[model samples]
Target: MTPLDDGPPHGRGREIWLLAATFLVAAAGMVYELVAATLSSYLLGDSVRQFSLVIGVFLASMGLGAWVTRFVDRAVSGFVWAQIALGVIGGCMAPVMFFAYAWMGEVELPLYLFLVLTGILCGMEIPLIARVLKEVGAAAFRFENVLSVDYVGALAASVAFPLLIVPHLGLMSASLSFGVLNLLVAGISLWLFRAQVSRGLVVVWAVALCALSVFLVQSERMVSVVEASLFEDEVILSQDSPYQHLTLTRFQGRTRFFLDASIQFDSQDEYRYHEMLVQPAMALAPRRQKVLILGGGDGLAAREVFRSADVAAVTLVDLDGAVTGLFRSHADLVALNAGSLNDPRMTVVTGDAWAFAAENRDSYDVIIVDLPDPKSIALSKLYTQEFYAMLAERLSATGVMVVQSGSPLFARQGYWSVVHTLQATRNPFVPGGRLWVLPYHVYVPSFGDWGFTLVAAHPLTPRDIHLPDGLRYATPEVWRAAQVFGPDEADMPADVNRLQSHALVGYYSAGWDAWFK
Candidate 1:
């Protein structure tokens, strides 16, 4: 038998407690990573950049924690006690971060630092657990049993994290609950090994764990305050929608829907933006017959198109059915779109626009590109020259197309790039086809101000537009004025947005940042 086996019959009891303690710690730390990623995507505005940085920072900090484990007091009881403490600290990490983000003005530095600290403590747990188990009579070096328990614990966390924890309890509650698990670990430690521990260490450990335990019960109201402060609005309803948190909030008589803290639509005056976007192109089109509506999942744009008796059928494609269903089923959302979604003239196809556009050909009379602003790599493809080229191939010979090019005065480079891209797109399909660019603007309270682009193969005919009988914002005069760009605003460089380099994205984002800041 091994020397380790000689100490006690199977070191099973010591190993089990060690696994439970570190398992609780690891699970809490993993959820912290997910919450941190979600938070960055919310406030910082880019999913790829946020997720990557959060992951990179967490990994680096974990490595540092393992390195620092070398200095932990070289004693079996000390190591076990330290694991218990680390577990408690890791447990409270998410709720503490949420409150810190809410109470503090600028939370980036402090948030990242705290994430790093949690990762470090999380990293220290396993080694300390193993050391304690070994000292308590685990075989001299039964690597298999130690690794097996660690793997089992890891497997439990992986299964529990997304399936049971995140969506059901949310990040704050999950953290607080894990805090209780840590306290339980500390309690078990005191019960099993109270004889070996110092009186002061035992007292302090018990007190601290018990104090943190109270936070678990009080977590909800605390979370509400944090959420309200961060949103800066009366949060009417909020839910974790798997993909993101879908929040409905109200401020100044305006209702807005937020997905992952990014505003989806401001309800008070979306008609102006939607009308202005869909109308100009329709009015310019020879006949807005078979319309392709991309990104206006709310059906507000579809309602505008249906105004024209000339439109045969409208193809509306949006990625998330949740967005479309909300507008379709919810009374508030249905009322906002003015019941256009119920119109028989529309066909809704829920799928990724990029992939769908690639499969079909020669089907649309007028294509209205009204997708969300390019906020992440996921949305970038829709704004690229390639998407426009596919759209160009799909359009009819005398067809007209208009794109809601984010913002012109502010997104000057991005705006001009779309303008030039459309200009480059016109070819012999219609020999007289000449690309023309028109600029327009609208104000959204939450977004402040916004812009659009009207592109056509031929100069518009006032008669072709043949607007639907009822309209709120777009008129013939408004259509004509939208094309008008003043002298001062004309100073932006005419540099075109090309497929190879997305320089305009940077320019537009920076310009908006400067204007807002």
Candidate 2:
């Protein structure tokens, strides 16, 4: 191969353009992979499994594509066509997957199909670029140059995807934008090698570019249409935050909030869930002056906390600021939470619950854990014995803590595992140097047979609990009946959930799968 220095001036210019194309295409390919994995995790439940499968299939397909490039005799045309194919497939991936989930109720087949196709096309780009550079009389370092630029571009994509793309542009817009990038690379390639390429290929490139440009411009509308199809009600708000996708829907004067497609609450009956979660813990605690709530970003739990006149100050720690911000600012959402998030007694801290508990210096008169179900490892960490121990350290001598465990009927073992973990917690302030854990349940029409576990230094009974006035659902009789469980809902043998084991995630997944499937 002739060195680039010995090549014609035009040859060096072509080489530079090809290298730049390599960088852009590589970045676009990585973003496509991330978008697929993120969408899969959002629609499906287990994030770890979804991401691992996506990455594995994507990498394998790339290897297959590289191997097939040996059969290609026309490297320039092959590379150009590959870019167009990638541009179309990668760009339409999110919209198609969302529609598939909305209409078909399953995205597994389409998800894998797009991943394999996108990965293969991405894999074919670099080798074909190297071949094209060699044909243009470039230096022997052409392969190294292409590979290094490709890797750096991939690094840039990985960083920007979470920080910028998902948060700012969202999955749909990000996919469409990168699709345009691929088409632009193809158009540029056609221009650079116009003398050698066919005019027919140029026409194809022009059409693909125009079509992708239209989609990129209308990406937000496309997302809205797809989201509207997914929900039964009108989508009032649909947003992508750094942590997750949030969607708010309303129908017949009832509002519903969802995180990553899982229902967080329904305004019509959310008071039942919130009142049951907060009332028992507040009534059992020796004092209710200073309360700490974890993972109640919607402020529903805080609303219940404020119902008690003794609550002088309440601190809420949740991971997502978007959730808290929406509840604090949106008029409808504010009314649902009864304006508790904006109350002067409330101090909202946007941070991780585990980290907050680990660093907390003050003890709370009552602590309420209103987190989501332990469906993934990240959420499972909060249910682990280690996390419960941290919470134990932050509870005052006579304070009580309550955790919103999952469905007792659907996730029997999961609910009991939380109870066992809290009971095993060794707290020095308690009478026996361990917590007295009590498991209870409430039946909400939306969730059915939901459970909560209360932890305190000393024993608590139904007779010891008190109900506040104006509560719609929770009462003395309801609290007494919640403590009873039938034979089917009885506790099962379960292992302690630890950070390393993540036993709760497995149990929760298995239990819900058996019920839902």
Candidate 3:
């Protein structure tokens, strides 16, 4: 009865535009979801928790949005409005959240609100498009065609998110870029159906495009503004690696490195941390000829490994090449680690430590796990029974492995969880019988009362410990003293960390939360 119902002169051509727009809208929608989850993980930590919450809220909001569309009388107008809303809201979501996290520190409400708003807008997309096509008498716009293109778009988004978007554009720019895509699609729709779409609506789309354009252009400078609020010192270098956000800050000749806003080490006391992590295991091992360093991409632990005359070769397996590359090339990092990453005897394999340990048939005399804390599921897997078993397989009979357990006082349960999990690897049913684990703690100024666990095939005591020369912080006496714990620091038995449960991440997050509060 309407001109649209009778079909435009170019009905087939319009259908093609609708299908293409459908594909892009679906892709852009998925990008928004991923951006929110990733940003939340970067700021809040516990990646599993952050992603779970974001996905749950986003999907639920999408459902609600779809349900609400049944009441819409104007399909074409609704689609245009939804695209504009999604573009503006989703495009600015990352920058707003980043700024909020750095300054306000209350992101939960705004985060969810944006997620719900964007999800609702995106939820209306496919349904409204389908309705518009039906109104235009385009019978080819079936549910099957719509869903299939949507899925393909989602697949593209998932692939591009890690490989292309986050790596090149960073979160802020990526958000704006996607927003611009949504606006561009909306503009295209407006131009194609100008006779149908209101002039007032065109103005709205135009204004949103201009606003998003300005934000995209200034995204880099805005990142610096956000970084200044989050970090204490002047941020000299920043990078968004595939694994995490890496930032280096300098203050008064001292430098600090942070991964995902959590401090890895400060130049002033990192030697202390590295020495405690590396020396004790090397000292206790019967032979330190072949050493395996897991997750110490900065190469400080390898520097300590090279200090021993016993070490023949060192193999370092760290996940992030960005981190290893930085430590190898940066003048400040090279000086700090004393160019350990460049040493010919040290072989750097930038990949998952789990895979490296599982695949490598060769045995190592000492294995040092100087990995970051199990703040996320991915990192927590490294502390699980499966991973420890893999490490045990590659360890020589007389080899000793050292793990940089989190602060004993701060993350008491988490520290002990690692201890229990490492012991579990030696389960009698499993191939690698049992391991002798000795837990030790040291008071580092930068990180108070840090912990380390030494796992050996045979029992080890203070007398078995050997100290390398030129050690600044740890001596044989200091190592022996570290074995002593106060009543408050007494070991609390915890469940073994496993890939299925990720109990360690919960324990670690809880423990650290209490400490900070």
Candidate 4:
């Protein structure tokens, strides 16, 4: 009988261990892939494109590794070495990419290089493990056992990734921790099959373990250095929440909040953005007793809302708990928003704005959709016709909703597309059915010629404008002039942003590229 039928006495037990190792390595491989994709999306824009390229390159490299495995003669030794290589590469992927992007102004080279390297190493791993298992009395079910166990591990990883790894350990720690797992898998496998391998491998293993241990403890230091090189100011706090990367920076007492590496607001002039976002809708609404804010977890808009005496109750729905919690607890952040989030009149709900709008039975007099710009497919959903339709259902008959449209001078087509989408939902035949929508612009020093869209079920005129108390920038005359646009900021006809088409993303991407790039 061949070694497949009659092997060492403990071969059967080793085969089970081999399957377990396979499960672990598969999970580690997926974690590395996802971590890379997420980091790329944070550094770069357009998550859909970033994830697609990383996955495609990784899978193809895996296939390449599998094909190259045909030339290997020693399966067990090859598998052990591959695991060590994968551990080091996967463990260091995040810091390496961050450094590459911050230093080189391009992540494409290192991103694909690591993907190919890790993919090939991961690809070589399974075939080698399967080959060794086949030689050790598991030949009859090697293919079935390996494939099934690999798939189960992948499913487990897919579930654990978002729920556990991202929220708790974060990208940097998760990568290092998985690397340790890879090292352990390799070390244990080598020890179990020591008689079949040479002694030189032990020295390599010892060095790698020591290096990884030191790196793991200093991961935060490395991340801080990388972020310092990348961002303009000193990063006071940088964390990876389940939803996005949150960074708070301070330069000469000027604080800036960035989500996914995109600046949300700068403290010096934030009032301009928040003031314009809140004032128009609150002023125009017939009643301001009930208000709904779709985003604005920062509480700056809530601060503006509290300025109106008519506001009895305010409901703020934002997806990220980290942000709202930060504003609530952080002394500086609390002071920035004038303690608006802690107001007894405010109720903070940590959930999806889209779902909250649909399920909410209560009608709101003024709804402020202070969401991020349509930079990705996920964010684009919030700006679509479908979302606007749901939003319309939650508004009182005389309510006005203000949407923060992107820059008209920079993203004119995108700005108008939001207006067109809201207009598409208007019903002209019924009384108070025809939606009266107008496009407006405000010039903030931080953001040039920013735009907003105002919508109501009935006709809106100067009579609807009611200036709130303690206003700094916006007055009744300013509110009237905000509706008028110059020749350069003229409105343009664009397709409505529909769920299927994602026209806004395309328009915004193209428009911003032309103006900014």
> Number of the top candidate by lDDT?
2
Error of 2 at 430 (Å): 4.9
Q: At residue 461, give the lDDT of candidate 1.
A: 48
> How high a TM-score does candidate 4 get?
0.95
TM-score of each: 0.82, 0.96, 0.96, 0.95
For candidate 4, the C-alpha RMSD (Å) to the true structure equals 2.1
Model 1 weakest lDDT span, ten residues long: 1-10
Best first by lDDT, ranked:
2, 3, 4, 1
- Best of the two (3, 4) by lDDT: 3
Q: Per-residue alpha-carbon lDDT of model 1 for 148-247, expressed as tens digits?
A: 6656666776677656676677777776676666556666766666555677877777777777767777777777777797786788777664455667
lDDT of 4 by residue, 302-367 (tens): 999999987999999999999999999999999999998999999999999888978888988999
lDDT tens digits, residues 286-307, model 2? 7999999999999999999999
Ranking by TM-score: 2, 3, 4, 1
Q: Each candidate's lDDT (Cα)? A: 0.70, 0.90, 0.88, 0.86
Instruction: Show where candidate 4 strays beyond 4 Å.
Output: 1-9, 428-434
Could you tell me how far off, in angstroms, the CA of residue 320 lies in candidate 1 after the best superposition? 3.7
Residue 394's lDDT in candidate 4? 81
Q: In candidate 4, which residue pairs clash?
A: none
Report the error of model 3 at residue 273, Å.
0.4
lDDT string for model 3 (189-275, tens) is 887777778889999999999999999999999999999999999999989888789999999999999988888889899888889
Superposition TM-score, candidate 2 onto the true structure: 0.96
